[model samples]
Target chain A: MFVHGLATNPGWDWPTFFQFFATRTIFSALWVTVQLTVYGTVLGFVLGAVLASMRLSSSPFLQVVAWGYIWAFRSIPLIVQLLFWFNIAYLYKELSIGVPFGPEFVHFSTNNLFGPLGAAVLGLALHQAAYAAEIIRGGIISVDAGQLEAAAALGIPRIRQFFRIVLPQAMRSILPNGANEVISLFKGTSIVSVMAIPELFYQVQVIYGRNSRVVPLLMVATVWYIVLTTLLSIVQYYVERRFARGTAR
Target chain B: MIDVKGVHKSFGDLEVLKGIDLDVPAGAVTVILGPSGSGKSTLLRSINHLEKVDRGLVRIDGELIGYKRRGNKLHELREREILRQRSQVGFVFQTFNLFGHLTVLQNVVEAPVSAQGRKRSEVEPYARELLERVGVGDKADVYPRQLSGGQQQRVAIARALALKPKVLLFDEPTSALDPELVGEVLDVIKELARDGATMVVVTHEIGFAREIADTVVFIDGGRIVESGPPREVLDNPVHERTRAFISKVL
Candidate 1:
C-alpha cells in the first residue's frame, strides 16, 4: 500500500512497513528476545559461578571433570549444541525422570529438549555457563592475597567471608569483562532461530515471507539488535561503577 | 605476661629458629636486637604464633599459643582457634601490611568487630581515640595508599591498638619507613612503652632500643646469644657476638 524510495527503486515498497513493524506479532517477538536475555544470563551466571568454584577444586578428579565439560561444550558451536540436544532424544528410547537412588520414581515420554522454547533456554544457559565459569574464576583470582588474609584475619565465618569480603571485591574486578559476556550472550540467542523457536529472527522471517523484501526486513531485525545491545551496555556501565568503589586505591 | 620456651622452627631444612627461650614480664618493653639473619624478626613473630613453631611452646596470658590437645596428644590449633589466640597479641609487620582496599578506619575496626564480636558502635570511638593517640586521627578516613610510609605505619599501630591487646608485637616496624619518617612511628612506640603494655619489638634503631627498652636481647644464627638490661647488654656486652653486633649498630 506504500512505496519507499520510489524514484530510486520503483519496487521498494514502504507504506505498509510502519504498520507492519507495529503489529502485535512483531512486538511479541521483541518481548520473547528480552525474556531469553534476562532468564538465560541469570541462570547461566549462577550456575557458572558455582562451577568455577568447583573448577578451582583441590581434587584432581573434579578438575578433570570441569576441564572436560568446559572443553567439550565451548569447543563446539552453539548451533551444534542446540541440534545435538534436539536430536539426542531420538537416539535414546526411554526418558526416565526420577531421583536417582533416592526411592523416588517418575517417567516421561521420550521428549528430549529440542525445538521447544524450554530446550532453547536450557541449551543456551548450559553452554554459556562454561564460558561464565572461566570469567568468574579470573575475577576471583584477581583479588589480592592480602585481602583474603585480611578477611580471614578478621575471623569472619567462611561463607560470610566469601559474600561480603571476597565477592564484592571480585565483582569490581570482574564486571567489565562480565558486561561483555552479557552482550555476547544476548546476540547468541539469535542462534536459537536455527531450531525454529519463533524468536525475533523467526518473526522477521515471517514478515519477509508475506512480502519478499529480504534486505529491509533483515534491516528491521538488525535495528532491534542494536537498540537492545545499546540499552544493555548502559546498564552494564552503572552496575560496574556501583561495585568499583575503593578499588581505585 | 608472655613465655617462649625452647621454641624451635624450621622452613624445611633451613632451621630459622633453634631452641630459643625468653621471658617477657608484663608491662615492660623488650627490644630484640640482631643482625639480618639473626632470627630477631622470627623470635618476635613466634611469640604471636605468626610463624608457626616446629617444637616447644609459646604461652600468652597463660594459654599455650600454638599447641592444642587431641586425645591426649598435642596438635597445632585450628585456624579458628589460632585467630582467637592471636587476637590477644596484635602484630605490626615491617612492610606495614595495611589492607589497601579499606580505609584507615575500617582497617582499625576489622579485628575487634569480626574477631572479638565487639559492636562497631563501641569500637569506632575507641579506634578514633587510638588513632589520635598514635597522632594520625586526621588520616582515619583515607585509604592506606593515600598516607605516607610513616603515616601508614602509625595507622598500622593504631590498627594494632584498636583491640586493646595485652602484648603488642612489632617486627621491624620502622625498617620499611624512610629515615626521616622513622621517628614519628618510633615516638608512638615509645609512648606505648611508657603506658606499660607488654611490648616485644625488633628494631634496627639502636637509639630507640637504648631509650625505651627494659630488656635488650641479642640473637645470632637462630639463638639468643645474650640478654640483660639494655644498659648491661647494649653498653657492656657479655659475648663477642653481642659485642660485635652492638659495636656495628652503635
Candidate 2:
C-alpha cells in the first residue's frame, strides 16, 4: 500500500520534473553553483597554501596567526558566517583601499562592492581556506623528514627542494582529504539558498513553491548533486594515480 | 682536503662530539670506527656542516664550510652560500636517502642540472656513466623503491658522484643493507677509494676499514682515542679503549 501511495500520489508529478529538468532556469542555477565552487576552490587552496606555509614557518607569530585563523573559522557555524558576510554592508557602510591609518586612496559603498553572490563566494573561500590549511599542513608533515634532509645535503635550491622533492610526496597524502573538502564544498554551496541567490537548491525551492509540487523538484536537485560529485570523484582518482608514481608496489 | 678543528656539538644535555680535530688529506680514505652513541657519525656530519658545530669550524680547501671570515670575526653564511658550499661536499646516509619519487637516472641528474645549473644534456650522459660505474646502469629507469636496499645505496653513491664533489662523507652506508647486500656497496666505496677520491666513512665494518681505509680513527665517549694507519690503529695496541673496541668488532 505504501509503495502504491508513493507511486500514484498526485505529488509525484513526473511530467513537471522532466519539463523543469532541461529548462534554462535549472541549468542557469546549476551554472551559478559551479561558478561558486570553482572560484571557492581555486581561491581557497591558494590562500590555504600561503597559510600552511605561515603555520609551518619558523616564526612563532606567523604560526599563531594561522592557528588562530583556523580556530576562528572552524568554530563559527557556516550559515552564520554566510549570513554575516551577506549583511556586511550593515557592519561597514563603505570599503576602501588606502595606506593603513592614513589617507584613503579610494572608497565605495560596501553594498555596491559585494552583492549577495560575491559575499557568498568570499565567505565560502575564506571558510574553505581554514580547513584546506590544516589539510595541507598535515600532508606536508606526513612526508619523511629525511627526504628534505637529502635534498638539502645535495645542495638543491630550497625552492626546488620543496617543489621537486617534497610537494610530489606530500600530494600523495593531500589528494584524498583535499578532494573530500572540495566535494563537501560543492554540495555545501546549496547553503547560499538562505540568501535567495537562485542556485540549484534555491531555484528548486522557487519552482516547488509556485507549483506546489515539492517532492519531485527536490529530487531534481538531489540527482544533479550526485551526478556532479561522482564526476569529481572520477577526476580525483586520476589525480591521485599521477601522484602515486614510485610509491605503489 | 677537509679540516675539522676543535669541533664540539651537543644535543640538549648530552655532548655528542667533543673537541674533535682531524685532517683528511686530499685523495685519501679516512674511516671512523666506534660503538653506538660514540659520536663517530656526528664527527662525519660536522665535516659537511650537516650538524652545525657548537664551537670551532670546518674548512674545505681553505674555505669555511658554513661561514665567512670578515676580519677577525666569523659570520654564518646565508643559506644560498651555505648551499653552494654544500654542493662541493657529498653526503651518503645509512638509510639510502635516494629521492624515492624519481628514477635512478633522474636522481643522479637532478643536483647537477638544478643546483649547479649544468645543461641537462651534459648531466644526463654523465649521470648514465655514473650509474654504469656503480653497477646499476640497467636499473636507471626504475624508481628507488623497485630496487633492493643494496641497489638503492649504489644509486645514491652515483647520485653523489654526479656532482663531482671535492669530498664525500658516508655515514654507515652499509649498515642498513642486508648482510648479503653489504659487499656490493662496500665494493663501490673501495673502487672510489682506488680512484683517489677524498672520503670520510663512519662504519662498524672493521674488516672493510682495514682493507680500504688509509687511516683508521677509533673513537669512544665522544672523543677520538687513537688514530693512525689501519695496521697501527687496528693491529697494534696503543690506547686500551681502541684495543677493546677493535677486539669486539673483529
Tell me, by TM-score, which candidate is best: 2
Q: List ranges where model 1 is wrong by over 4 Å.
A: A1-23, A55-65, A91-102, A105-115, A247-249, B37-50, B238-250
Among residues 3 or more apart in sequence or in different chains, the pairs in candidate 1 whose N, CA or C atoms overlap within 3 Å are: A2-A15
lDDT at residue B170 of model 2 (Cα atoms):
96
lDDT by residue (B175-196, candidate 1, tens digit) is: 8988999999999999898988
TM-score of 1: 0.85
What CAPRI grade goes to candidate 2? Answer: high
Model 1 C-alpha lDDT per residue in residues A121-228, reported as the tens digit of each score: 888888888988898999888877656654554444556567766787788767888888888888888888877777888888878988787766776777788998
Candidate 1, residue A7: Cα displacement in angstroms equals 13
CA displacement after TM-score superposition, residue B160 of candidate 1 (Å): 2.5
Model 1 chain B scores worst on lDDT over the 10 consecutive residues at B93-102
Candidate 2 residues A133-167, lDDT tens each? 99999999998998998899999999999999998
Off by over 4 Å in 2: A1-11
